[model samples]
Target chain A: MNRLNGTLLRTSLRRRSFSTADNVDGNLQGSKVQIFDRHLKRKQRDRAAWLINRKDSLVNTVADNLLDRLEDVKKTFPTTLCLGGSLEAIRRSVRGRGAIQKLIMMDSSYDMVKLCKDAEKDLASDNIETSFMVGDEEYLPIQASSVDLVISCLGLHWTNDLPGAMIQSRLALKPDGLFLAAIFGGETLKELRIACTIAHMEREGGVSPRISPLAQVRDAGNLLTRAGFTLPGVDVDEYQVRYNSALELIEHLRAMGETNALVNRIKFLKKDTALATAAVYESMFAAEDGTIPATFQVIYMTGWREHESQQKAKRRGSATVSFQDIQKEFGAGETT
Target chain B: MVRANRVVEISKTLSEILVCPLSKQPLRVCEKSNSLISDAIGVSFPIVDGIPCLVPKDGKIIEAEVSRDGDSANTKRRYHQDGTGGS
Candidate 1:
């Protein structure tokens, strides 16, 4: 019985560590060490879905910020693919806008996908059709040149190969199709990360990867260009949300289905370590009001599939005015 | 928390855009089974609550007989009024 139990535990532990990317790309199998375990993430998100209908404060806010960029576009998209934008948030916002006609919503979690039923009801008289799909964005599963627009909000951070995912999305777009995304990047949850690091070290004399690394802001533009997207653009934005305490922030992360799912992540924090983490967070970042602030950095990536109708840059030497005349012609006030 | 072999009823409009996650080939409904079949991939994907579960690792759901007047009746009503790009 003892031997059987040990085998069972080892098997379960090994299964739990299986990551998503290796299966998506066979070449990466047995060679690369990936961080996020996609199945564990799905299970985590699935379990979280049962507890709350939770249109998360940070997720909805960032989604709204991402969608607001659509108004600047002159034309509407006939078929738009939304990967992991919160259903309740996006459905209500798109009711009046002509931005999308047929929206394909995809997520890795079936529970999250099921939430679409309740979300769609709020779109009464909106005259839009949506198809919800359960998929890991790494595989994408979209046909080349199928969609008019592909947008993702705060979803790609967990992807094992973000660059490969971006390339797949680019290939899935129709010519001149737009790809716009907002990913949590650049120093998100810095305070919590620091607090957890300190607490773990003090309690256990060592640290494990408590938080997953995110994409850097400086690399955003190059990622798009590497994916062969045309007219790429990248921008950064930050939002601050105040939690009564660090424990409350952790609770919010759970509610948001944003718990750490890194493959090598410590399974659970010790009770004393948890208390220490909260205390450390309070000392370092608490405001006069006794609330702690969590900062989220959003990186927005925009690009387009190459098309004949899209604008193009002129030849290198074709400019009428030279750079040497910048001071004389356009430098002061009369350049216009 | 996920159950095995679940059948979800969905709309005809939704069937149009769904392609096999493995092959990216258009999927067809096996009217007898009500599962989305991809001939190219030779695998049937399961749907839960109108959302097609495309990931293969979670495994296929148990076959359940879904009727037009059943769980998907709600979706059919909305599809009739709002479905665009329908054949």
Candidate 2:
């Protein structure tokens, strides 16, 4: 009995140690990790579907603008990483650019990763070597202060651990490394959020279908600074597309692989309630234009990691001020 | 008192739930060395107090996944068996 108990104890200790070990790497792969993975999977599937069905016209239209930004990015950093980027789009942008060395491409779904890899093989871009990893925005598997530049497009806003992801991105960057990303703004899916909320309130009187969260420009910039990045810059642009119907907008969103995979997605949507909601969505369409507006909030951000030695000095200076000095400043009781 | 910068070995379940902030991968607690190892990056972090200083500035890098796999089932069963003490 004693031997058995010892064995049990040893096993318990080892498992406990393993879990604790993850903390060292800072992965946070528990419940929150699942939430992020689910979110990315849903979004990617929806978006990819939209792009394929639409004949790639829309994606190609945006290619030039995206390519222009990539050109500027290449000049800024020697190494770059693109998170949740489709292979075709990234290849088109970075074609003929020789400044970048290694480009780490990360996404959550295996299907998307495979799709991206297949597309990359066809491109034959020899200058930039690609490393594909199955990961989410929240739990990135990369070294700290190693990557020279980090760029994510249309992905970070959907992450459950936005702040955590931002912090990790900052840590992954070397001092003066550039971080660039484009995400949906508050205006994204505005009509959908409004219609869902109104329908829910009218029927059972509650919140609407959970929409993917998007970051505000100010908030995105603040996140960069909070994550230990310096010289943070953020710009938001609103691009409105006229959709023939509300359902079309949702369908496009779905095809683009953007879906609501929030951990708190309503477990059950009553069939009757859902039908009523759909009707409500249809009712709101403009009679004249026969179009619903889908807004894309594109955010461009650039920041550099602050060198560790500079930070250490600041901390040391603060420490030298002493607890008693702080207490005095707070106007506490006089020192003895 | 659990003071900052003091190394403390954590329970197994919490470790599974906790992740390295940088790599977002699983971490292994090296209690003997008072460090946490990132298999993907081959970095080990020292713990201070009950908290692990996962920050790269403070930790050292070691071999990868030396103690992560081949030990899940036994750990889970022990957790259920240990009653109040296992977490």
Candidate 3:
């Protein structure tokens, strides 16, 4: 919990169901930033290290997928964007010399921004030059047509403005630029959301459910098209994990620095009903493996910015300029 | 374990002074778990090392060990007769 001892309190933390973008109170911004800055403290670091271990297992399975597509990414754009790039873990996986020219790690959470900046220490010398920006996915601070590849891992689902974020993502890319992202899809926490809902309704008249709903990749592809990305591709995979108990699951989230910052938070528990609600939760969701099951859906998407040449050809009404000729000309060291 | 000890020491100093951010209610250090419990929130904030994560997701709502049938009689009397509901 964030506490302010002697700071101006003109605003409060706004709770929203989707994003923390507009919810930050102007007055509390400093304190909130301060809290995030303290993320590297001994306790917080320990928690983060623990959580990364859990998340790494799933990340490893799809490590090949991220690497294989780098050639395609390189062909399209020189600069790559990793949205909510947690500790720059994805960077370590891409094992080539100067595979990407520039890396932009974007996250609204200050702690994550700090983490990415500090991660410079862990970067390889031959790795692409990296930079950090703090902003929500929906509203990036970078200029339009500035980026070549946009990649997000397990972070887009938390965006309050998912559609807007996607649109902004497409707008930021140059025509022919690629967009790739992964997130927990709808089936992700289905069991948990259901169990929590049932338990809350049974025990208390009602309880707040905070599980984020993720979009399936097909739906994501549609979003990409709507956002003006060309030849969009979508694929899905699930990672099933077992945790020791509800507490352990929670600890893992905390360690990963994932917590609810949604604006629409419920204030008070129903009259004398919280304890029973927790009991119901434990009984229903606790597993025989002594670990609660968490399923993550990783969505991979690739799309190009509509090539300007295609538009030019369409207007000219003649197929004079060939792609091969353009490739031959631009392929000889194209400047991104 | 050393981290846990540091937390304990901090909790002892913070127990009476700390108040809930949301409700502004007085907080007490839970003996069993060494967590901070706010009567208003009905949740225990786990104390880790020297830090207390009062985030709702990190909190565990207290469950009365007493069954519903057993609780109806005593809790009704306790909640109605006394302002403090044995929290």
Candidate 4:
């Protein structure tokens, strides 16, 4: 479990059904409703492999922003693992420096892995090797205490067992190893969520959960700490993208492989329900200029595998100055 | 990779850190079969186009190979989950 005190957390861990065991479909009578369908997600990503390889604008932005975290660290990570996004982008972000000696790229989707492998074939040689593998985040393929760094970008939200995935990642790290990741936070796509809810409630007489649930930013640090990580740091970033209309926004989600992957989701919305949703989206949430605003919240998390050499917080009651004295020294009502 | 001219194989660095997701045992690269095999787990994972498909669902049982090796007196069965060699 990721504990609350670490910095650097890797996201984008896919929980694929690689068990070789199959449960009967439409069998939600007794079992809990699965939020995301791992099989469908793999197919969806495979379908979007071309778009991902070509660098969709939003994907590029998030991947670039996430990789920027590496610039602050001074130590070299001899073994580095990355999941999601393009390999070319990863190579560019870590370019020219000695931070990574052997870079391993992994993804649950075979097509996506192939897309990345095809793009960065030149990086492999006798000295620096790049290995690509089809791996599920829920079941990591690395040995314990093996890798120095692990980075995940824009993919963890799909995992059914998010905590388990994080735990496996922690196990894959050596002491003092770093984990950096970016995941969709709770506030992401709020406009879409609201629009869909209102639209369905109006048309179908009740609302169904259409949007995928995201992890809350507040819980990220705690989760990391509980996962056996120390010195955790978490931050949230929001981006607003404007579409010409709500319909365009939905289309954008479809093309970018961001459509709902919920297993218990309604297979299709009635034609009028969709139209009503679009109308509701435009009327209730759109800007005065008639543009639809989609809010995207990303929670960036970081943590370090606990090690003896790492710094620790000082004990309590160690302050040099008392609260009243500090207040008086700065500025208070009765300093005398 | 250098796979253009030579046989496609898992690199030394990668094999060092990789393990069976099910049994958590170190994988031995079998270049002849283009797969990563773990005799201890009696499972082998295929490597296609230089990418290792290590998913458990895709794993293949290799008990026959392990039994053949057991016939020889040189190696001991040290990888069994129960810590005893299987009969």
Best by TM-score: 1
TM-score of chain B of each: 0.49, 0.52, 0.59, 0.63
lDDT of each: 0.74, 0.60, 0.57, 0.74
- Candidate 1 local Cα displacement, residue B50, angstroms: 3.0
TM-score, prediction 3: 0.57
True contacts kept of each: 0.66, 0.11, 0.00, 0.74
Residue A140's C-alpha lDDT in candidate 1? 73
Error of 3 at A310 (Å): 7.2
Best model per DockQ: 4
Per-residue alpha-carbon lDDT of model 3 for A89-151, expressed as tens digits? Answer: 566665562257777665545454555556668766754666554444544534566777787
Candidates in descending DockQ order = 4, 1, 2, 3
Tell me, what's the RMSD of every candidate?
A: 11.4, 16.6, 19.6, 8.2
Q: Which ten residues in a row have the lowest lDDT in candidate 4 chain A?
A: A1-10
lDDT of 1: 0.74
Pairs with backbone N, CA or C atoms under 3 Å apart (clashes), candidate 3 = A1-B54, A15-A263, A15-A264, A16-A262, A16-A263, A16-A264, A176-A305, A243-A291
Q: How far is B46's C-alpha from truth in model 2 (Å)?
A: 27
Q: List, residue by residue over A174-232, the lDDT tens digit for candidate 4.
A: 88899988888888888777787787878898876688777889889877987778889
Interface Cα RMSD, each model: 1.9, 11.7, 15.6, 0.9
| Candidate 3 per-residue C-alpha lDDT over B1-87 given as tens digits, one digit per residue, 9 for 90 to 100 | 754565455423234324554444676777567777778857677655434544334567777633367658757767856876764
Candidate 1 residue-wise lDDT at A177 = 91
Model 2: per-residue Cα lDDT over A280-325, one tens digit each: 7667755566666666767767677775443333544566577878
Query: Would you list the rank order by lDDT, best first?
Result: 1, 4, 2, 3
